[model samples]
Structures are given as structure tokens and as C-alpha cells.
Target: MLGLIKKDLLIIKNNIKFAIIFIVVFVCFTEQSSELLYFVPIFLSTMLFISTFSYDDYNKWDAYACTLPQGKKSVVKAKYLASLLLTLMAVLITLILGFIIGAINKNFDAKEMLEIISGVVVAIVLLQSIMFPLMYKYGVEKGRIGIFLGVFGMSGLIGFLFKYLNIKIPNNVIQTFNDYWFIILPIIVILMILVSYNISKKIYLKKEF
Candidate 1:
């Protein structure tokens, strides 16, 4: 499992230079948007990690991996663990960059920056939790398309419901969420990943190749 985790992490490490360049360019072009600084790293890390699935499929890694003891379980568990590590590294990079940018701009608000980073991390984790199971059940190519359409369809449905149903969130509720999101979001994300991991593991183990 450790070897498997290292293999995926090495893949990300090799490709991260390009991600860094793109992030730097984005920062230079949109210096005003600190939120983007926090978001792009985590988003890119997620993409980079997802790309490993394509690589695995292309190399036929799964079929070979299943020959090893606990192979399917190792692959799935390593993937989730590697993703968490990459996310933490991305967040750390973003945190450092946020501080540097804040210092340069002379408008540094530690609390605000932390909040934005936390929110972005939570959102990305939620996305990954949804997508991972689909990717495990279907291969990466189909999974990507499914995720796109699913997100679009879900967004449209929510918007339609909001517009037609006149559903309004109370200010008090919003404030309550704002007050407790730091505590609540982590719990939700943890539960999501655990469920997602189990689903993905089951799917992978049942899969023939």
C-alpha cells in the first residue's frame, strides 16, 4: 500500500511543475483575486491525481495489480490516502502563497484567508467524494463525462427549484451555518470520503479488470 501510494505521489510530483507554472501565471494575471490562489492549487492537485487513473488504465495497471495480495483493496485505499496527502500539500502551498500575497498587497487578513482556503478545500473534497465512486465503477473517460453532466444537471435542478418554488434561506440559518461551518464541514467531508471509499472499494473489487 505504501509503495502504491508513493507511486501515485511520484506521478503528481513529476507533473506538478506545469501546474505550478499555470498557477503562477494565474496569480500574475489576477493579483486582485486571492481566492483564486487558494482554489487553483487544490483544483489542480485534484485534476493531477485524477489523471493518474487515466495513466493506470492506459498502462493496464489494474489488471496486473489484482494479481497481488489485497491488490484491489490496496489500490483503492492508496488512492484515497494519496489524494488526502496531495490535498494537504496543496493547502499548505496555498496557505504560504496567501500569506505572501497578502503581505505584498498589504491587506492580509489571516482569518479571511483561512476561511477561503477552508471553504475551497471543503468544496473540492465534496466533488472528489462524488466523482471517485463513479470513476471506480466506470473507467476514467466515462466517469469524467458523467461527472460533468451530473454537476450541470444538479445545478440546473437546484436553480429551477429555487426559482419556481420560491425557497428562501433564512438569514438566521445562513448566519448559523457561517458560525458553525468550520466544525460542520469537516464532519460532512469525513463521512462523505468514508462512504465514497467504501463504494469505490466495492466497485473495484467486483470489477473483472
Candidate 2:
């Protein structure tokens, strides 16, 4: 399992230049934007990590991986683990970049940063929970389309809430969730990931490749 995880990491490492460019672009946007978009990097990392499935498919890695000792389950597990690692890295990077930007602009807010972090963690977990199983069932190309549609749908919903309904979410609600998140979020995320893993594993197990 560790070796499988390492393999995915190596693949990402080979694409370090692109990742660096992405980070720079995201950092620049976050630094300039007023909205709490600090979570974007984490979400982007999750997407990029997930896109690795397409790369594996392109290279025929999936068919080859089936003959390996670890089998499809390990392959699926490694992708999930790799995503988790990338999310953690994104969190750390966001923290550092947020602090630097705050220090420069004299607008540091620890509570807001924490809220963003917690929100990003839950969002990525939930998004990936839905996405991984779909990818396993439908293949990466369709999975990528699904992800884009999901994002667009989410964005539209938020827009409708804010624009048409003139409804703004209360900060207190966010605060309350963040207060209990240490206990609540972990349980929810873990259960979701476990369910997603089972689904993906079942799909991969029955796949011809």
C-alpha cells in the first residue's frame, strides 16, 4: 500500500513544474480577492490528484496494475491516500500564504482562516466521495466531466442563493459548525470516505481491466 502511495506521489512529483505554476496563480488570485477563497488551492489539489486516473488510463497502467501483487484495491486506496496527502499539503501552503498576505495587508484573521480550512476539508472529502466511485464506474474522461458539472452546479446554487433569493448565510452558522468541527467533521468525512472506497473497490474489482 505504501509502495502504491509512493508511486502516485512520484507521478505527481514528475509534474512538479505544473503544480508550482498552479500554486503561483492561485496564490496571486487569493491574495487579491476579497472572498474567502483560500480553500481553492486545496480543492484544486484534489482535482489534479484525481486527474491522475486519466494519466493511468492513458498509459494503460490500470490493466498492468491488475497483474501486480497489490491488485486493484491497493490502486484505489493509493489514489485516495494520495488525495489526502495533497489536501494536507495544500492546507499548509494556504496557511503560510494566507499569513504572508495578511501580514502584508494588515488584515490577519485566524478565525476566518480556520473556517476556510475546515470548509475546504469537508468539501474535498464530500466531492471526492461522490467522484471516485463515478470515476471507477465510468472512467476518467466522464468522471472529469462529472466533476466540472458538479462544480458548476454548486456555483450556480450559491449564486442563486445570493443573487436571486438575496439570502446570505449567517456567519454564526459557520462559526457554530467550526466550533464542533473537530469532533463532527472527522466522523462524517471518515464514513463518507469509507463508503466511497467500498464503492470504488467493487467497481474496480468487476472491471475487465
Candidate 3:
């Protein structure tokens, strides 16, 4: 597990240019700080999925990956680990940047920041619940579409609902995040990821090589 995670993190680190661009864009933009936080999970999960999947498929390394000593289970486990790690990292960075931007602007507050963080986390879990199974069952080729649709469509619906309801404080809808999510959400997400990793490992192990 450690070796697999290190391998994936190293590859992501090598793309310093992409990371720099993301950090720059995210840090410099001050207009929608909350929105930025809300989007970090989306950005991290989707980008990681696309880059990792495309690299393996394009290089025709699925077979090679399956042959590694770690086997298909390790490959799937590594990818899932990478996704979760990157998602959390993105959330942390987004929060730090959001906090700094808020301090500079004097418009953002503690409650708002917490709300932003909560919204992003909820979005990540919701997206992952749908995307992982698709990716686990179908691999990346057929799975990317589900990833795209699930994230974008849900985001669009959330936006529409906010607009339709004329919500001034978008954070209000998720106000109880601290109480419910902070306590219950992590347990749920961890359980989901563990279940996903085991199921994906089984599926990968059974796949025709």
C-alpha cells in the first residue's frame, strides 16, 4: 500500500506545471472564494481520474499493471488511494488559500469558510459514490462519461435549486454541516472507500487478463 501510494503521488508531483497553474488560478481569484473551495474536490477528483486513467490506457499499461507483483488489487487500491489523498489535499489547500484571501478581503468569515469546506466535502462524497462504482465496474474508458455527467449534472442542479429558491446565503442550506457531517460524514466516507477498494480489488482480480 505504501509503495503503491508513493508511486501514484510521485507521478502527480512530476506534473509541477499543472499544479502550479492550479495553485495560481485558485489563489489569485478573490471574487468567489467559497465557490473556489466548493470546486476543489471536483477539480482534484476529475483531474486525477483523467490524468491517471489516460496515462495507463494510453500507455497500454493495464496489462503491465496487472502483472506487477502487487497485482490488479494493488493497482485499483493505488488509484483509489490517490483519489482520496488528492481530494483531501485539495480541500486543505483550498481552505488555507480561502482563509488567507478572506483575511485580505475582510469580507469572508469563519462560518462562511466552514460552510465552504463542508459543501466541498459533501460534493466529493456524492461524486465519488457515483464515479467509483462506474470506474470500478467499467474501467476508465466507459467510466469517464459517468464521472463527467455525475459531477457536472449534480452541480448544475444544485446551482439551479439555489437560484430557483433565491437563496442569498447559499451556506444556509448546509448550515448543519458541522454537527451532522463533521461527525457522521467521515465515518460514512471511510466506510464507502473501504468497501469500494475491496470491491474494486475483487473485480480487478477477476477481470480477464
Candidate 4:
């Protein structure tokens, strides 16, 4: 499993230069307080991790991996672990960059930074949790299209509903979320990842290659 994880990390390391350039560009251009400061790097990093599936498919890694003990299971485990590690690294990098940007802007709000980080991290994790199973089942290229359509459709639906239906959240519910989110969100993310991992493992176990 460690070797499998290393393989994915090495693949990502080769592309780290481009990821850094993206991070720098987003951080420099966006406001210090903008949520993009926290989101762009993490999204880019996770997408890089997802690209490993493309490499694996092209190289026929899965067929070769099946010869090893627990190979299929390890492959899925390694991917989720590697992705989590990448997500963590992105969050830390953004935290450092956020502080620097705040310093330069002469206004740093720790609570606001925490809020943005928390929201962005949860959103990315949820997105990945939804994506991994699809990537495993459909392969990377199709999975990318699925994600695009899913996000686009959901966004459109949400906008239409909000504009036409005038749906609004109660302030108390929003406040509750804001207050307990730091505690509740992690628990929800953990559950989602666990479920996503289980589904991906099942798919890979039954997969042809």
C-alpha cells in the first residue's frame, strides 16, 4: 500500500511545478480574503491526484497490480490516502499564503480565514468523495465529464430554484451551521469518505481491470 501510495505521489511530484504556478497565480490575483485563496490550490491538487487514474489506465497498472497480494484493495486505499495527503498539503500551503497575503494587505482576520478554509475544505472533500467512485467505475476521462455535468446541472438547478421559488434558509439554521460547522463538518466528511471508499473498493473488486 505504501508503495502504491508512493507511486501516485511520484506521479504528482512530476506535475508539482505546474501546480505551484497555478497556486501562485491564483493567490497573487485574488483578494486576500477571497475564498479562491483557499479553494484553487486544493482543487488543483486533488485534480492532479485524480489524474493518476489516467496514468494507471494508460499503463495497464491495474492488471499488473492484480498479481500482487491485496493489490486491488491496496490500489483504491492508496488513492484515497494519497488524495487526502495532497488535500492536507494544499490546505497548509494556502494557510501560509493566506497569512502572507493578509500581511501585505494589512488586514488579517483569523476567524474569517478559518471560516473560509473550513468551507472550502469541506466542499472539496465532498466533491472528491462523489468523484472517486465514478472515476473507478467509468475511468478518468468519462468521470471528468460526469463531474462537469453534475456540477453544472446542480448549479443551474440551484439557481433556478432560488430565483423562481425564493427559497431561503432560516437565519437560525445558518447561524447554527456557522457556529458548529467546524465540529460537524469533519464528522460529515469522514462519513462521506468512508462511504465513498467502500463504494470504490467494491467497484474495483468487481472491475475487469
What are the per-residue Cα lDDT tens digits for candidate 4 across 1-209?
Answer: 99888999999999899988877777667764555676777788887988888998899999999998878779899989999988898889888887888888888777888888878888888889888899888988898899888888988999999899999989999999888987789999899999999999999999996
Q: State the weakest 10-residue window (summed lDDT) of model 4.
A: 27-36
Instruction: Quote each prediction's TM-score.
Output: 0.95, 0.81, 0.75, 0.91
Clashing pairs in 3: none
Rank order by lDDT, top first?
A: 1, 4, 2, 3
lDDT of 3 at 49: 50
lDDT of 3 by residue, 86-121 (tens): 777877777777777777777767776776676667
Could you tell which candidate, 3 or 4, scores higher by lDDT? Answer: 4
List of clashing residue pairs for candidate 1: none
Residue 159 alpha-carbon offset, candidate 2, angstroms: 9.4
Mark the 10 consecutive residues where model 2 has the least summed lDDT.
28-37
Task: Report lDDT (Cα) of residue 190, candidate 4.
Answer: 92
Model 4 regions more than 4 Å off: 28-35
Residue pairs clashing, model 4: none
Instruction: Tell me the deviation in Å of residue 201 in model 4.
Output: 1.0
Instruction: Write candidate 1's Cα lDDT for 73-186 as tens digits.
Output: 799999999999999999999989998998898888889888888888888887898899999888899999989998889889999988999988899999988999889888
CA RMSD per model (angstroms): 1.3, 3.7, 4.8, 1.9
Candidate 2 residues 1-209, lDDT tens each?
89888877787778768867877776676666523657667877776787678789899898888788976668888888888888888889788878888888888888888877877789888989989998888888898789789878988999988999999779998898767888888899899999998889888889887
Best by lDDT: 1
